[model samples]
Target: MADIFDKKPIAAFGEMAETGARPYYRTAAPDAIMAGCNDYLGLATDPRVVEAAAAALARHGTSCSGSRILNGTLPLHEELEAALADFLGCEAALVTTTGFQANLAVGALLGPGDASFSDMANHASLVDGVLLGQGSRHRYRHGDLDHLERLLAAADPDAGKLVITDGLFSMEGDLCPLPGLRELADRYGARLVVDGAHDIGLLGACGRGVAEHFGAMDAVDLFTGTFSKCFGSLGGLLAGPAGIVEYLRYTARPVLFSAAMSPASAAAALASLEIIRTEPARRERVFDHAERLHNGLRALGFSTGPSVTPVVPVHVGHAVPCLRMWQALHDAGVYTNAVVAPAVPRGRALIRVTPQATHTEEQITRILDAFAACGRRLGLVPERAEHDWTPVALARPKLTP
Candidate 1:
């Protein structure tokens, strides 16, 4: 019999890994600078967060060893869920072992004959979640509410409808129009679900997320988030109405069958959540770094699409050039993620960089300087623009559609 594994195509990073070309997987490099990681608040290394994990390891042992529905319901799990619910201003919350699993749980709630409207650029977890439900999926253009409204108008009004989108798009780094989505949901009698994986602890006046940033927190029906990014820990949360959460607690496959989240992860996430609530300076500093980095890149004439948050992308138009650009940046000691198809469309390859609150002025300057050098050498941007490049405004106001 033929081997099944031979049919699987090799991944893009396989070549790099085989050659030991930089050991990007390991973070032990003495001088490596990370501009590509998702640790937005810089709390992953906080002493308090570390201490909390240590305490949990000592107190609860390592693992819950079973699913949450059975022997796995620990006190720490309940405490973290309550904390997440309160932080997101929701009636209840469920903590899962991973953010991907959290999205799957929400997706699994959709039944046959139900309908789901997703953004073209939504995270893969959201896409996979919709597939799990085996419902009709209608994907609208990314961030275009007009397209979504048109699609919704043609769907059967009586069918159960779920509209799914990312609060802050991870790759393009733009905020979704939540108010418009809510208005559409109300008009069509659909439920609005937001995956705030990249938004929570990094947006709004108080970092409540995109819904709060847009003053539509009360309108969103389901809010899903991850602890891996801002919390600097390993877990996921689904916060929403009490009845719905209670329903998913027993129905979602991952929660019903998978092992419970590790004790250390729960404790660390709890500690990080508390810090996010109390320290407004971290959020402020993150935006400060983002503004400086965004402005500096735009000044150099690199196209950064409609980004208002810390996640920034350098739009290089093809795959090979993007990889080349990444290699150049890597060789220069700056670490960034080079994305290509199908993370993005063909010919729309780009480099993604994220800045954290812990990054200093000198660090930001070094990142910019390296980009300027590599960008000029690659001819990705003009050596000097005859006229200054105009900066695109953060986000346009959402009007009634």
Candidate 2:
């Protein structure tokens, strides 16, 4: 009872606000380098993306003011869906008001007679969606193909089956086993669904996403993605065969009940998608930057758990230390996300660092320098003999509030 009463609320680190689309952002410390945003290509601040939204707002006003089933369907909506279908190499696609809703719509298609095999590390939206379906939910260990295979083999042969996984695991910064999951789906007569929230505009040679990266584009039964991450907009998209997509348009409750996406959002996503396809250099830069950051962190004696993508998690092991590290880094003019219990398991707290294509080399260097200083001060890493430990931080974060 004493422990419970004395427990304090976890430190709130959600104070950073973007002044523009660049690497530096306005926070309590004035200006700090943004290394934690999900905007992989930095398209959120691109002039083209901004102009598209402005143009859309001028042309279509503000809100759709109704669900797509009623009067909400606009020309931009259809155009974006068509463009998404072409980009993703699907027969058809449907746009949702939110990525969370997209997953809910897909998973709600399953019921008592259906079964869903999910990865243990899949996004909460996918997990909750499957639960809402009221189906037999079989959770396999994270990225364990052998365990997934066994689960699939043991399920009822005649019951409808679905396999759900995130294209990229958000916490671990690892990708899903697409080829393995595809093979398992073929063997077990299950439809494979992917939540490509972090994959679209980043994965594959042509930026088609995980299926394209794995050469299983045609094998996937459903591909769901979000505009918030890659496109720097707001909304979700689900791409599949015409029959399935058409059925979802008619039957998905989220689509029927929810207000349609704002016109500016649809336009911005469409514009961003075009730029993502045309600008190959942006994608290449992001990959190279991710590699540099990953190697730099490991060399500084920080453990990045299985990260080969832009999303990098530096393992801190304990919740308190993790919070301290985040604060230290914040004071040194670098912003990062502090992951703790409820988001991850106890003793697995971490600092998540994500790099953007638009981040300059100088910004990256500054970030590394700050991390080195903070890590050494916190005893999180060894002190380098070559460098003096002068603090670069202007102010430390306020943890009480």
Candidate 3:
């Protein structure tokens, strides 16, 4: 808990929680038509994933009770890592307690003396990782390869450089230009790191991720992802060449100090990976749902970003109206997230909604219907719920009290 003494506020600060207005929580379905959370492939509720976790609980009790590098290392952990490496087509893979640690480990240990380059809109975990690392870094414009090239060209040629970006922007649902970034990285003598946190089971031809989406297999140098989204698991992974992974497994602070993940989560990860590899139809369904929302919103005259993925954000210009729009949607029995100032810049608040593979066609249609109705009532859509201008966010969300 935070100290009450820290609650000192200036005249500009306003009451959000006290006003009894905020639209964000992780609860079970109130009814069946709910659509907000981003389990894009919707594997979290799969029978196979649930059963695997349950079986692990029965055999291993509840927790591992130690760190993996210490007494917490179990046979199940090794088995899961081996399976993940094969599935991701990486030489080796290291499983961490959560997605946050997975990225942190790499950033802290990988570039001790090298220079780093990151997209301005990369995940917070990735930013934190870079800050904790031994190298200096330059943040390029969001998904702008030209800006990245300019930064790369101006950097020291003798020093090592690594470029990083999110394969899919979580809030905007737009894809990064991987192929173009790869070309720039190679021409400038830099290694590329791609965060596939959202793209793993949602993008790519067979869900192999963005490397496959843009056919940049030869260009990517490092890769990281989470099991919670598509794997229906609750941990993170760092996959790459064998030697680098071994170094992280032994030296990363989060891995060395934190207790290991439970066997239940490990089992769930294994089951989820298997399902993702075997089921291509799940990804297809996710894309189909996204396309429907994109078309429907545009037809209603709502301004959306250039997104080609499952995440769709309906732009709302101010914070107060954004909150009202979120509340109206909730009253209509649909839930979504409200992003306001600082999370987004001033005058660019938005109501971000996501559609998943498990969401039926009727569910998608209902969400669009709610948007049209609530938007009209709120006047967010002057011509029918549409606004212009892109906000500088999609991920790296700050805590909202």
Each model's number of backbone clashes? 0, 0, 2
Query: What's the lDDT for all of these models?
Result: 0.86, 0.84, 0.77
Best by the lDDT measure: 1
lDDT of 2: 0.84
- TM-score-wise, the better of 1 and 2 is 1
Off by over 4 Å in 2: 1-30, 385-401
Q: Report the C-alpha lDDT of model 2 over 1-401, residue by residue, as the tens digit.
A: 26657865443332222111122243534578988989989999999999999999999999999999899999999999999999888999999999988998886679788998999888888888887786688999999999999999999999899999999888878888888888899999999999999988887777877777776688689999899998999999999999999998998887779999999999999999999888867877887777777778777888787766888899999777787888788878899887877688878989999889999999899988998899999999888644322211111111121
After superposition, which runs of candidate 3 have C-alpha atoms over 4 Å from their true positions?
1-20, 25-29, 110-112, 382-401
C-alpha TM-score for every candidate: 0.93, 0.89, 0.90
Model 3: per-residue Cα lDDT at residue 61? 78
Give the Å error, residue 352, model 1: 0.5
Best candidate (score: TM-score): 1
Task: Provide the global lDDT of candidate 3 against the true structure.
Answer: 0.77
Q: Candidate 3: worst 10 consecutive residues by lDDT? A: 392-401
